[model samples]
Target: MNNWELLEIRESLLRDLAEFIEDNYYGTPAPHEYRRHELDVRLGKKLKFSSSYPQMTIRQRRASDLLLQVGLCGATEYALGTIEDEDQLKHGRERLVKMKGDLADLMRDYDNCLSEEERKLLLRQAKNNSNREESLKDSERDSLLKLVIGMAVGAYCYNPAALKNDAVSDITKDLEELGISISDDTVRKYLIQAAAKFPQARKA
Candidate 1:
């Protein structure tokens, strides 16, 4: 009914959506459709809960329930393994490169439009925003590359004694082509970590 109550419910819904995405996407094995069915059932239970947030009006309840349903579908599609993981990696890498180029152009345009004093202030703000963007992009890039490394390591771990050395070259070359600054040694380290993690999962 009140703004705070609405805001609180929205935040809770967002956290729930994110949890559904992460748990279903990475934690569950295929076929993901089964996990999606389970998610819908769990979401139904959550919606029935009468929390401290003032009782939602009929319109508000309908909107919130619809949002949950739509969010689940969108998350499922985003995390869907319809394509090979390698293909998804290439797509994500390309998107980041395009985003960087777009940001560069935007900064240039913004700089051209400002007065000298305003430019200085805006530049400071831009730099701060840029740092935040870089941090987030770095994190996302690391996650995607880890998946790449996992694929290679999974193959090697399939039969460790017969492991081929070219896995490093494979991942390193792809990363370099995508403008990732990591070294071959770093890639090797990531592969080693993946190897360790995969076996532990298998044992469990």
Candidate 2:
């Protein structure tokens, strides 16, 4: 019920609503629901975890997609993917400059009114916007995307032509031996998604 706790709760509820909206509105129905169900099941497991963070992240008592002008910049950062190299970075900076300026302008209305804690939060946020943090975000995003895509790749190897069932199992075994934390089910889901994207299968 403290301000910090309240803020975290609000953010979590907003995220869940956003997830629902994206699945219901933007994503394909059957597949999207499948993903949503998967998320829910994973979340159900998380409920038994003895952590406040998990509770704060999902299954809230109320929905709260009522954020103001400051939208999902973090999620946007997630979805926009990432730009590699200084040249791409510089171009992105140029494009974001105008938007950042606009944000600063909006913040001015509450400038003198901001709490000390809020001000420090803003300062850290500014530091985080520097390339180092952006790179960190990109690295994190890449890890998750790779998991999604890699799972698909592992799934494809499940039924490779000329390979016996035991041999195919060994192929997935090799992938695990290589140190990737993926499940056979995740791999199967990824393969289906990959197939949906390509017009025709290409020899690898």
Candidate 3:
């Protein structure tokens, strides 16, 4: 099966298993560690954190947990999907959309922060201050960057593979779906550069 399909199958099984544990094992005169271990084994993803963002802390296992809490509280109509009650999918979609909006907002800020004159000045400064800015700009890829900026953004936002594979997949996937058209590899390379800058900034 494809990765997404495999994910869905695994998710369905894990969901059923978790529910079984919660209902039958929790406070049911039975040990719970085995159930927890089974669930953990089912969820084989190991968490790798990034010091750069230092912002996103996923408290729940998945969006479903948050959706379940909302259901318990009668928070919104969203918790009721077509399947009687399980708005987790809806919540996941909303969460994805919200993340996309956030990335767009950030990109807008980046654009607003840098005026044409400032860009020229910065490019000039970079050329003067850096060791190989000119040579780097002379590359074929450098020329393509001017043509590919929007494509890059679209691709970055759409391809979750580029970001989620790292610590910042949420933004990356949302961005990919948001119509950014750059390649996933480009996004990863840039994100890595940004992460590299983070450690250097702290040192400075």
Candidate 4:
């Protein structure tokens, strides 16, 4: 396949992974956060990379980043499941097995689309990125959890009083459905924090 076709396959895989995580793990990043736009002038430059022997285009870099995120989310789900719930743990393990196979196939196809030298360069870069991600896994996992909590808070911001009453259970239930195993007390804590930051939400 050509480079664009490979990119499309990567994009499709990323989307599938995101959907699976949102359905069975926790949540995925907001769609708008990943979309490229003409107004996003900085994104183009941020995604471009150059070297003396090999280079990565903006689209290729984006695919690589998406692949990394997909891997991170899958790993995080497995880690969370080990501590959170037995069902989740089982699901995490199954998903990871499938994901490994899918990723391996994608990498093979991606390598086929590149020259030998480019393949080596990309492999080296991917390894370095993976190593860096491993070092930051804890912080990244925390951030992901926080993002989910923040989303939960924002979802109920319009009805702050509900967060204190039966609404708190509703919020927790909703989060649980999204694969986020948050407690009512933790939900309340986040509500309070959100209220403190945006006092108007309390009035709402």
Candidate 1 whole-model C-alpha lDDT, 0 to 1: 0.46
Candidate order (TM-score)? 4, 1, 2, 3
lDDT of 2 by residue, 96-182 (tens): 565545544543543444457866775554555443434756566556555544544455443323212232234445565666444
Please name the candidate that would achieve the greatest TM-score relative to the true structure: 4
| Model 1 bad stretches (over 4 Å) | 1-54, 58-63, 75-133, 136-204
What is the Cα-based lDDT of residue 56 in candidate 2?
Answer: 45
CA lDDT for candidate 2: 0.40
Runs in model 4 lying further than 4 Å from the true structure? 1-83, 126-204
Per-residue lDDT of candidate 1, residues 121-173 (tens digit) = 54455566556545756567567655755566465332222223555656555
lDDT of 3 by residue, 1-204 (tens): 222322232333344335323454323232122233333332322211223323322322332232232222222222222123346656755665664454344334433544588546545544453444235644554445433333433443323223133323344455556654433333544554444433222211
Q: RMSD of model 3, in Å?
A: 20.8
Backbone N/Cα/C clashes per model: 0, 1, 18, 0
Count: clashes, candidate 4: 0
**Stronger candidate by lDDT (1 vs 2):** 1
All candidates' lDDT scores?
A: 0.46, 0.40, 0.36, 0.47
Q: What's the distance in Å from true for residue 192, model 3?
A: 1.7
lDDT by residue (tens digit), candidate 4, 48-144: 3334213554336554544653444334442542354677667777777776666566566545555677656545655665565457566665565
In terms of TM-score, which candidate is stronger, 2 or 4?
Answer: 4
Q: What is the TM-score of each candidate against the true structure?
A: 0.25, 0.25, 0.19, 0.29
In terms of TM-score, which candidate is stronger, 3 or 4? 4
